[model samples]
Target: MQSDPHHDSANSVELPTPTAWPIITAFGLTLLFLGLVTTLFVSLAGFLLGLIGAIGWFGDVFPHPKHEPFPIRPHDEWPKDVCRVGRTVTHLHVGEHGHREQFPAAVHPYTAGFIGGLAGGAVMAVIACAWGYLVDQSLWYPVNLLAAAGLPELSTASTEVLKQFSLAGLVVALITHVTTSVLVGLLYTVLLPMLPAKREWIWGGILIPLMWTGLIWASLRFINPTLNARFEWLPFVISQIAFGMVCGFYVFRSTKVSTQQGWTVAARLGVEAQHPGEKKP
Candidate 1:
């Protein structure tokens, strides 16, 4: 007797059964970490939940994986296609210009990013200094605060000490500020092109600043307790916005270069042989 093909196909189409063990394990892990911030009781509860979940999850697969048989519908019960057919599909060659469907076919050069970063950093410094002078009556206060991230001495220094100028603080602040600005500027070059063209400015200038500010606000306590203690949210936010706006505008105005994504590795490395008839200019 011949076996029924449909029956065999249906029997072979077994899928893994849905289980709550994974979610339970995830919740357990979350609580376990959250306990670091809260209390040991939560961690104990999480450990119990995690152990139970792990045991149950392993039981599903130890000897044999658990699966459920999926019901197969007859061909006659399948939905009919209503869309038009036989439309010609256009094929793209790998080396062809603008053949990629992904956004950002081009990007600003590294030079542009570097210059933009410097410009933005200058603007940000100006704003920060102004805030320092206006609010703390000292031009060195903000600089000292920034340097405190690296200088442990400054971290514990008195408010009066922060207000006084220190050559070491100035050097540290300048280096930190420049390095961070340039890195963020390079990131902007990569990010801005992926955003909607019309809304790039809004995202780069306002939204991005606010987002990083929130992140810094949350993490600052652990990263630098001193800066977190004396940190003024308003001034810091303003300086960040100023940096973003200046950097974004500069990069936006700079000329973009085609990405070499479509080029062959040899061509990108300038090792591809030129065509016989091609003239070197």
Candidate 2:
């Protein structure tokens, strides 16, 4: 047996494992590389998206903007139901209300919508029909393209028809978003159900008459921008109550059986149905 030399030193220090340093260094480098790659990717995507958006906006856009929120419980009402529910949302969340609720986004978009009444309401003051005409042009461009490519129904007269549709859709979407956004929170959520308790639609999907036939009335009787006298404040107020009884009744009529994915439901009588995952109170 070989004898060890000085094996009983009182102040000996143990050495760390050799592989630990390399592993730690490798982890740090990997984190740094991942951060760099993510940053670069985001920057590139943002730049490309901005460039494309700018090009599209250079001329015009129909602005068929629509957005819907995830319902308080949305799973109960999608995928297959063809019915409608709910009504036009006229109010949006404003700062004061949100401060009270301690919510994010500063605004509740449910009824008020994405743009609400802001974009067009601002643009209309400065540009007049130029914006409207551009909007009209945008709405119909798809149809014109189809026609130009020789769609059987519209190959010959696609341009004229497309122009009309563009003009109409632009007029409608803009007015709807704006008039609704002018308020202070969603009026209500629209829903359409297909069964007593099975499926529902989040937005009711009603193409409520937003600005139909009323623009001419407003311009002729309301706005006088040259004299600086338009129904500038009136359109905002006129749309306040967003109640179309027709729509209300239609949505109410479409109720379905509220299932697990839908609203809280009970049976048809005095007895209560136990919730899937709850214990008796």
Candidate 3:
């Protein structure tokens, strides 16, 4: 004698009826786009399928949405282990020290990151320029390589052309270099704090640069064929290390501002006082 699943259930929920119209409509849309590269007949078939699906979907919802009643079994029918409730939640007061373990309790300000980035970028630029001068006897060579990723004209340029200075390449390189430097600097502020303070330099300056350098080496051909064809790995790795060290050190030295994790909503929003003795900002 098997008992009915919903025998003890008194309440039921009316959930939306499952239908195949949506699948048909999606298939039609896929075919419609596929037809652009195939034939008009495929497109016509897709349109017909889409129209029929849309009409059927609309019919299911227009006058009154179609729904199916789902009976919920009583709690007694549930497995004993699943039915057991966990311990009650305890709420912590805001700004209460040592209440919970919060990571990155503070962080360096954006201004610090910005300044660090500029400093790092300057150092990186100097190293890159020095590499170009030493290797190719042309200061413009490295800058041209950096810009070659974005500028189509430079992609196929000869080694002699790459050594020659171009105004367009200089502008592109400057923009790309500054933007990347600043973003990475800001990232350091967030990431370095999460690492062990005693060995942050090892992770940020050495390990991180090596890891990303390897990644870039692997993907450079796809990202920039022109640069990949003429990439000097040792110089690139050195520059990356210099940038990371400079940026990480600057950010680590900067004063850290407390996070808003311990602040109440009102305090965070500056709408009301956080504590009884505190004044609203």
- TM-score winner, 2 or 3: 3
Write one digit per residue (lDDT tens) for candidate 2, span 100-128. 22222222224232232343233332233
lDDT of 3: 0.82
Could you give candidate 1's per-residue lDDT for residues 81-154 as a string of tens digits?
A: 68889796674543344344233445788777888889999999999999899988999999999999889889
Off by over 4 Å in 1: 1-105, 264-281
| Sequence-dependent TM-score of model 3 | 0.61
Q: Given candidate 1, what's the lDDT at residue 197?
A: 67
Q: List the residue pairs that clash in candidate 1.
A: none
Which residue pairs come into collision in candidate 3? none
**Which stretches of model 3 miss by more than 4 angstroms?**
1-87, 90-104, 265-281
Which ranges in model 2 have alpha carbons more than 4 Å from their true place?
A: 1-18, 21-228, 232-242, 261-281
Location of the lowest summed lDDT over 10 successive residues in candidate 1 = 1-10
Clashes per model (N, Cα, C within 3 A): 0, 23, 0
What tens digits encode model 3's per-residue C-alpha lDDT throughout 16-57? 779999999988988888888899889888988999999999
- Name the lDDT value of residue 48 in candidate 1: 87
**Candidate No. with top TM-score:** 3
Residue 21 miss distance in model 1 (angstroms): 62
